[model samples]
Target: MGIEYVSVDAEYPMCCPVILCDICNKQLTREGVALRMESSTPQEPKRSPLYFAHRGGCYSTISATLEDLYGSGWLELSDNLKDFMTQLAHNFNTPLEHEYTQYKLT
Candidate 1:
C-alpha cells in the first residue's frame, strides 16, 4: 500500500466531497490519511479503492489490518511507502518511532 491524493468536483455551496473512513466509517477530513492498496489472487491482481482513516487510532487500526495481511515487514518492503510514512509522521507531529521502527530512514 502507498499514499495517494484524490480530488472531486463539487457543486456550488459544497467545498469538497466527503470521504468516510474505511475503518471507523466516519467522515474523513483533510487531516485523514489515505492509502491505495492492491490485492492479488491466483488469477489476477486487483486494484482496491482508496482506504481512508483518521490520524492516531484509526490509522493504527488500519495499519494492523495491513500487517495481518502482509506481515510485519510490509512497510519495509517498499522504500516509497516508508518514505511517505516518515514524512506523514513528521507532518502530523505523530511519533512513529516506536510503532514503526523502519520509519526512520538510514
Candidate 2:
C-alpha cells in the first residue's frame, strides 16, 4: 500500500509548518522561489513525474530527487519525456508565485 503523486504544477503551498523532503529528510524550504511538488496521492504502481526543490539547484539534489520519486517502481510517466519535450514547442516565459483569486483565466 504505497502512495503516488502527480505534480501538475511546478510549485506547492506548504500545508505543514515543518515539511521535510522525501529524499533528504531535511526541512523543505520555499524561501523566495516557488517550490516544486506533485499534485495528489493516488495509489497506483507505475512510472510518475517528479520535481523537487533544494538548495539553489545543487547537483546532488537531482540524483536524490530522482531516486526518491522513481526508485520503487511507483512513478508513472504517461508520455515519453523526449517525445513530450519535442512536441512541447511553446515556452512559458515566466511563472508568477501568487494565489489566484478567480478560477477562470479569461
Candidate 3:
C-alpha cells in the first residue's frame, strides 16, 4: 500500500476571531481576534493537524494570554475577558510561598 494523506478537522473551530481589548483593537484596527490553523498529512503521522491557537496570547489558547498581549500593547483585550486576565496576572504575581500557605491556612 502506498502512503495516503489523511485530513482531519481541528479540535476547536479554525479562523475564529480573537477579540482583544478595546484600545488595542482600535489602535491596530484588529478585530481583537486572531486566527489559528493546523495542517498535517497521514504519511507523516507526527505531522497530524494540531490546535494552532492563535491571537489569544502570542498564540496561547489560555484566554489570559490575550490579556498579556493587551498589557504589553500587543493586542487589546475585551472587558468581558478582563476578569479572566486579572486573575491570571494575580496568579503570576503571587509567590509560591503564598500559594502553599493559602491552602495550609485554610
Candidate 4:
C-alpha cells in the first residue's frame, strides 16, 4: 500500500498537536519524524473546511486519565463530587492543550 500525507491546521480553543497526515491520521511525536510518504494526492480544494476554518484536535486525554483511576486508588473515593472533579480535571487537559496549540499556531 502507498502512503499519503496531508497537513491540518487546527488552532485553539481548539489547539492540538501537529498531525502530520490527515488521511492516515498520523501524529508528529517528539520521538520521531515522518520522512517520506507517497499517495494519490487528492486535490484538497482551496475552499475546504480545513482551509477556511480553525479547528482543534479531538480531546481524549482527560477521559484516558480518569479511566486510569478506575484501576488505582482513585476508586477509593466515596464522594461522587470528588470523582466528578477528578474526571473534569482529566478531561480539561486536552482542550487546554488545544488552546495552547492555537495560540502558538497564530
Candidate 5:
C-alpha cells in the first residue's frame, strides 16, 4: 500500500461548543485558558521549537496531545510518557526537572 495522508475535520458540532484545555483536559463552555511553549535560544532541536496548547478546544487539537501527555496524576501516567514530553520540552531548553514535576489531586 501507498502512504496515505490524514485530513483534519473542519466541521464543528452545533449543539455544544467543543473546547480543549492545554493543561487538564477539562472542557469549558465559556472562555478558557491557553499555554504556549516556545524556545528562542540560539541552539534548538529539529522539528518545532514553539508549541501552543489551548484550553476548551476551540478549533484546535494540539491541546489533545497535552492531555494525553500528562494525565490526572503524575503516578497515573507512565514514566516513559512523562519523559517523552519532558524530553520534547528539553529539546527546546526547558528548565524543568522531569522527576520533580508533580500532578497530585487534592
Candidate 6:
C-alpha cells in the first residue's frame, strides 16, 4: 500500500483519546508509526483503519504483514517503503558508536 501523511484522532472505548500499539496493545506515549491499506481505485481511494504501533519492535510486525500480502521482496518493490523501514529501524536500534550521541541529544 502507498503511504500518505495524515493527522489522526482516536476516541472510542477510552474517555481520553489515545493511540494504542496494534501489536503490544499498549498506549503509545512517544514516537510511533501508522500503516494504512489503500484501495486500488485512484479516483476514490478507500483507506482501511490505521494500524498504529511503536517504532521499534512493534513496528517491525508490518514486515511480516507486508510479506504475506506482497511476498518476501516487498521492500525491493518500492524505494519509498525501503527508506521508511530504514528510518524506523534506525530510530530504536542505533549502532553502539551512535548510542552515546543519540542518548545525549534525546
Q: Write the per-residue lDDT of candidate 4 for residues 1-106, one digit (tens) a residue.
A: 1123433444524443342333234452332212111112333212111111011232133223333533211121113233434564698784532221111110
| Model 2: pairs clashing at backbone N, Cα or C within 3 Å | 6-39, 7-38, 46-75, 47-75, 47-76, 47-77, 48-75, 48-76
**Local distance difference test, per candidate?**
0.53, 0.35, 0.32, 0.28, 0.35, 0.51
lDDT of 2 by residue, 1-106 (tens): 0113334345874343333344444444442111222234433222233433344443256545555754432222223233333333332444545433321111
How well does each candidate superpose onto the true structure, as a TM-score? 0.41, 0.23, 0.19, 0.16, 0.21, 0.44
Q: lDDT tens digits, residues 18-90, model 5?
A: 3333344444233433233322342544122223233334314554554476432111122223343456567
Summarize candidate 1's per-residue lDDT along 1-106 as a digit string, tens digits: 2233334444444354355677877665556766544333424434343466777898789889876765543222122333545665686976433332122211
Q: Which stretches of candidate 3 lie over 4 Å from their true place?
A: 1-79, 96-106
lDDT of 6 by residue, 28-49 (tens): 5546666654344445533244
Report how far residue 48 has shifted in candidate 3, in Å: 25
State the number of backbone clashes in model 2: 8
Which candidate number maximizes lDDT?
1
Residue 14 error, candidate 1, Å: 11
Question: After TM-score superposition, what is the CA distance of residue 33 in candidate 4 from its true location, in Å?
Answer: 2.2
Of the pair 3 and 6, which is ahead by TM-score? 6
Model 4 CA deviation exceeding 4 Å by range: 1-12, 21-23, 36-106
Judge candidate 4 at residue 16 and give its lDDT.
Answer: 39
- Model 5 regions lying over 4 Å from their true place: 1-17, 22-24, 29-31, 41-106
Candidate 4 structure, TM-score to reference: 0.16
Candidate 1 wrongly placed segments (more than 4 Å): 1-17, 38-48, 72-106
